[model samples]
Target: GFADGTLRLGHLEVKASVLTHDAVPDGLTKLDNGDSTDGQAVYADTAGGQVRKVAVEAVLGSPQQIAPAGTAVVAADYRLGGTEERPEKSFVTVDATGIGRLSRTESRTNMMTGEVTETLTSSVLPGLPTGVKVTTVIMNTAADMVLVADNTGTLYRYDTHNFNAPVLAETLKPLPEGVTLTGIRFLIGEQSIVLTGSDGSVDVYFRLPRDNAKSSDGYTLIRAHQLEKHRGAVVAIDASQRGKMFVTADDTGEVWLRHSTSEQTLLKLKPADINGHYQAVALSPRENEIFAVTDGGQVYNWDIEADHPETTLKTIFGKVWYEGYPEPTYTWQSSSGTDAFEPKLSLVPLIFGTIKATVYSLLFAIPIALGAAIYTSEFVHPSVRAVVKPVMEMMASLPSVVLGFIAALILAPVVETWIAAVIISIAVVPTAWLISAFLWQLLPGPVALRYGGWPKFALMFAVLFLAANLSIAISPLFERLFFAGNFKAWANGSVGSSLAFTTLLILPAVVGILYFVGERVLPSQIYEIMRSPNRTIAGVADFVRWIITLMVGGIISWVLAGLLIGVGLDPRGGIVDTFVQRNTMIVGFAMGFAVIPIIYTIAEDALNSVPEHLRGASLGCGATQWQTAIRVILPTAMSGVFAAIMVGMGRAVGETMIVVMAAGNTPVMDWNIFNGLRALSANIAVELPEAVKGGTLYRMLFLAALSLFAITFIVNTLAEIVRQKFRKRAAQL
Candidate 1:
């Protein structure tokens, strides 16, 4: 107990009679004076409106002389700043009575003599009622702002950067109608406040930015979470020195352990023999023990065993409103430079990223692998197939780390410069192949048969090469005409550019559907005439049909895109926003290169294993090789082809090194081809080494692994079920 400038702890007593000016100290705070060997304590002399400090030493054994640290003139409660290293050199004090006023004081101590000198500044804090007295003052770790509470249960926020001209930022009434405010303290990092009320309420408030027009400072206080209520008025509260845990004591003699971020009541303890109301409570420095003092001068202590109080199911899987954020969001920041940092471990973004990476890679790999397998199995000569199959199979042996390095260092920069050309080639290459095939069919019968073996394949390759180069040469002109000469800027958020880009992305599908419908809608007489034996007439008819289908499809796509944009449903704002250099496009291309060989090899083997008798029967029935392969062989081999694709998808889902190096490793949930992602595999690879064993991060990484395993197991199980159905259907043949 403290009285007459004397403080007693167990069997020890400290006297500072002269420094207190014979006034009894109402509040006391111990400070780390930056020396492990010496102790310093500050006392608030509210009656005299002064703060006093004394150096404590055990050897001296007698009452030590106390010195004046600073003065507040009408001091109520004083708290020092939150800098851990430089401890307690600056503090703020609130007025005990009168219009709301605060004192900001800084002290400098002599190293040798321990003499202290102070500089004091005072300011009137606005937003409080006219005649209310200030009761408690608390400052954040940054020390640029302070929260002052008045006797009327009103909280006022003051900007203390300019000490003489403090600005009142916000006014809040957070307590209930009949409840009085007893105490408030900042949790670790000072981004959250724990307030105790006279009606046994414990609530937490987070600093949020204001959305009102009257406030220009852009900040307000909000009640975010409330813990379990106490049985009586909560008289004393104290927070942990290291984490989000705190201890509170009520008049009913019950003490509760709680966490701020998780909003969990960890434990409750009631002293067995205590019968009086507790006046003060404290958490030990390491947070392993709790100490409470009753008004009858009795002290009770309890040992605690709480760990990882900040982690919970809601915190790991659901959206959380973290400190210093505007609203609740999915975030994955796991570590920081400061010890007071909060750990955010949401795994939603990583799972989304894993699925996204798999889908994009399969979109790039499946068509090319299957197309190559069909051509090799049905049309190529035995000698050429021997060479091509071996070479394609050898591609699977390349190292993924080497591919990631090439993609990140070489492909990303080149693609960013020619992305417009790359997109144009998607249409150009397929159209060039179609036109070349039509022209080749117009050749005389003997010449066509003579060159159809290896020469045909070589010519097709040359045409593809020429088409790619043509797109690259025309890229600058195309961008200038369609995207205002700056595709990146246009893609970011220009009006009509997003619609135009969307139209182009969906153009191929639209054109294919139109072609299919055109064939069905054509008159039978004209179709037979166009399919006549004359090569020149047939080729010209088909070319004209293709051109008409393309034009009509483009018009339909433009109208559809415009209608979507009119409804505020443009793709630009959601999954397809902002262009990033090293993004999903680059990672997909690199991982597809790693996945293609497995699919191609398996699919080609399946196609080659089809029965020779089926081919003979189709030919004997006057069916062409192309018709036989498409209608007969492909249906029989569908089950094997699908299994191969599923295997490739599994490879893409578990890929680590390639995505880690080339994907920019951002855990964002966007589906834009130009945005970066961080997959579960990559996240585990990158963060596991730094995670401490038996820590929250270490366990969370294991959970990520479990999620990945579940995804693969479920997909494979479904795939096997579908494969069996397909195989049963094929058996009837």
Candidate 2:
């Protein structure tokens, strides 16, 4: 028997071939008188005619269907008592007449009738009981006594040596008013008789040994304490062959096991939809198996088995105090070598990976998508806008798998090669616009007044192109100055070096340029909207001074943080080895590429959907184009833009092949931008096909899918709330 839903069986032994006349007679056979339990007729053989031990087995009419039609022999096993050194065992058989026994028997195959031919020995009961017919027999070979219950509920014990002239040892007293005996079993170890009566009750009669001087009969029988009974009349009673635990079956088809030492029911079973008295009950020697048979030959076997440990809740989701660990940890390792390994199936890491991917993707996509959308709607010439809008909208149709392939095979290598160049580009690209805007005003008054928005943008693009090359070209200078020949070596080896180029030139330059353009360089009305309102600060003038202070202060703080993080990276004295490649940078850029078109298309459409008259009114009232776009159109379309960003976010969160190929599939918990992670969708795609059906790993994969669903649902719900708030603000505008 197994908890994994399987049963193991041994080889079958044919009863007739093993129980032949010549073979069984030479062995220690039971005193073949019809008793109770399995009718095991014989067990062992001794060299001489002096067998010391015997075993009872082979119950006759066990299933009731096996009972022969004509004059056939039926067997029951019983103990005939033995010396202190050995216990004597035997079997009892019955014929058509009534309950009878056989001291000897011969069985053979009848050629003509094709039936087992049986011959009974004369060494049996000389005559049947007289005056009252006996219902059940129990033999106590220790005191050479035989017990019997008659039809009138009278119990009698007789000397086993004499059959015809039986010496009666006791005449039992009457029972309760309406009680009638239905079944009986001998409790050999307790020297008691267990009786199941008509009124769903069980009573025990124990034999007490008399002192040698008191009487020649040496023992007296008396009624002992009664136990809890079945709800209906019990039809069969039995116990483990060598145990004190007993079992009973009632008319209602309920079976229960109870110990003779106590009245407590250890186990109970009631099969559904079948209600009738059981004909037989047998407890296996192992104490874990029980068999019940009805009169119609219906047989049922029940077994007790234990479950496998993997399904326990503690092993699935709970934090396990794993061996060899300092503290309990939430881990999600599903399998490893060794049978004793306990699986750690924590969902925390998967959830963290999902959030990390979504966050990085959003950070990379939102600014670029929204900026392009703003340019096309508010600044671009209509002819160019028509081409720009449709082209970006078409990009939305590119397959994500193709994008993932590009990220894995192309983008990761490119980023790894120009790692510093890329970081410089983020700051450089924005400065291009500031520089170009400044350049437009620096032109001669005659030249500036002639061309409008189109020529200004062309200058902006030229500055952007030069700035991009400057960013890439300046990377080597920054590396040599601050990074001791290589930036990767500085990151992977040590912390202190010369001041970075970004620190000496780019930082102060960007700070001065942005601050001046935002306050003193641009229009005063723009300054009025952006500057602090407190008159104590003198508004715009002091605001510029404060801005310079903040920018310089912010740059210093950023450098300090970078140095601190660099120091912490070394795990031992002067050593750090893990290189940064194919990490969050690759995943962010690649997923951002996949996400930008989605966001840009939707956002441009949303911006286009806003009423054109609002823009015209703002411009007609003498507001600059930037002021009109910022103060009017953007706020009105805020809700739709938020929705577009969320849609891109959903795509980022569920992306598989891109992150799977680029994110390294490392199931670790770390937020460092240069490290990789394992996302849930990637894990599922990688593991599901390898998992066995109906196994623990297979179920865990399905659970991971469910976790992804829950994350998406929660994100969408929160996004909806923020969208509603934006919609309300747009209404006010």
Candidate 3:
């Protein structure tokens, strides 16, 4: 359609001229009638600055003026209100001053005379600035929202839900200095806008809620992504009806096919390939072909092959600067309710989550599983071993989903309540065990020999049980002393509390180092005295030395923590940050419970398989039963123990239901034991059912599965190699 009211149909190859309307004195500024078959079209006349409706036929009907004269209509849009067969029509006109009028037409029929009459109603849309030269006025299909662009590069967003009292939602200046906004159009979903600049820059802008905003309707327009720049001014832009893909053509005769979400330039066609410089371009209804027409009456069509343009190696694996994010980050939000939502498909977080879950699970599982294996195989009586081994093996049959259910519904809350006690137990239980062992050595030789083996194990268990209960009883005092009565608040608060938390966390390491250094630095006379034949004297000396070591280690840790804080190294981020209830610690505990039975069973079987003669020989040489087991049996079974831990690791890596239900399923890249995580397996289990076949999310899920497989393959291969080395070393032993 031209400004002279000449309507044409068909392409350049075969064109047909439609009815030409009566000439206007100042030509038509805009023409719109929607998809109407009634031959009625509303157009804006510049001469009288009036919006007039005219019937198109062999001879055009008399112009029925809608708006009053002298009000210049700069732009107008029409939309269908009812069914296509009997459409109620509405149109809005924006004058040069940016004020708009919405007019709706309703038809009524006289039943007796069979005469049809039309009624027109008008309402003022108020919000836009007055006296500004309006260049474009666009209304969404619902007619409740409008965008007005004036000559100044500013875009006005209006909420016209109440047409007579429209609200101005936001205004945006998306262009930079010296770069004029050439045109703007809504993408397929109308939630995003494609803004083109005179400098050939194309950018996407969308509405996002302001962070911590006070108002419910507080949203700001943000420039999300910038596509490939054109060589010259972009003349035409059109978006596909089905997807986020769009086509842009520049005056330099270059056409580029781009996707909004992935920010990918799928294809580019030069002027030589298209044979014309198109001034206007459009995507076909099916989005399979692009049709473009040049001002010189030349038309060109190109087929587009852009399936899965949103997925690439870089987009899937690397950090992406997504629509509303301030910086590039790894994210994995795959699907949303709206068509305009951008898919964040990065797999880095999932992978990190898998590793974190495995490592934490192993940390909790290995010591307990191996300790139980050693005790059952060597220290415990055969009857106790017989009962314990079967019970441990039976634990492996418990379903992971059942464990996850218990963890999420019961254990998580309990652990959160007793978290301070749990932390205190880490230090208290081991120290209590050492004190109990020293006390046992102090007992008379006759009584010690009489209450050995099962009695000894029972005694140690009682000591640990008491230690655990004591830790729980003192939990409040411990929190008050170190954490200011609130562990979470203290841990996440100032540097002083962070330093205190860091010191406690590193206390065990400090103690271990001090023990090693003390063994070398302490007088030989002291060790000899601790090993004296007098049981009471040796035990008392050993207890005093252990107490002194603990106190020194605590003092050193406090100093080290202060130095770390002084250098801006607070222990409140990365792996350890703000605490949550259903977090990595709870998941680790649940997953560790699931992994322990596997590791313990395999390791116990391997320890039992070791030849009894080796143990007998070591004991025959006057070494203790503990010495025989630690020096001979453990080394010979090291290969199997290593393999058991590796197998348990594989189990943890592939765990889905447990992490899904208990881990909170957040795809965040933090190692904080108190924070939640989402693993690759859990992600696949959660999202696969909703993913469309052959879609980007479905393919990415498959890729996630492949990555899991590769991780297990590499881990098992390395385990086997290391196991072989251990086996050869055991052969020499």
Q: What are the per-residue Cα lDDT tens digits for candidate 1 across 305-398? A: 8988878888888888788887787888899998789888899889999999999889999988999999999988877799889999999998
Model 2 global lDDT (CA atoms, 0 to 1): 0.65
Overall local distance difference test of candidate 3: 0.80
Q: Evaluate residue 459 in candidate 2 and report its C-alpha lDDT on the 0 to 100 scale.
A: 72
User: Cα RMSD (Å) per model?
Assistant: 8.1, 22.1, 9.4
Is candidate 1 or 3 superior in TM-score?
1
| lDDT (Cα atoms) of all candidates against the true structure | 0.80, 0.65, 0.80
- Candidate 1 weakest ten by summed lDDT: 1-10
TM-scores for every predicted model: 0.86, 0.53, 0.76
Give the per-residue lDDT digits (tens) of candidate 3, residues 29-72.
33254322222343433345433344433533223344455555
Return whichever of 2 and 3 wins on TM-score: 3
For candidate 3, give the lDDT of residue 312. 77
Tens digits of per-residue lDDT for model 2, 153-268: 66655555543334555666436656766777776343556777877787766556646423236566655546687898888999655544678989889988865433446688
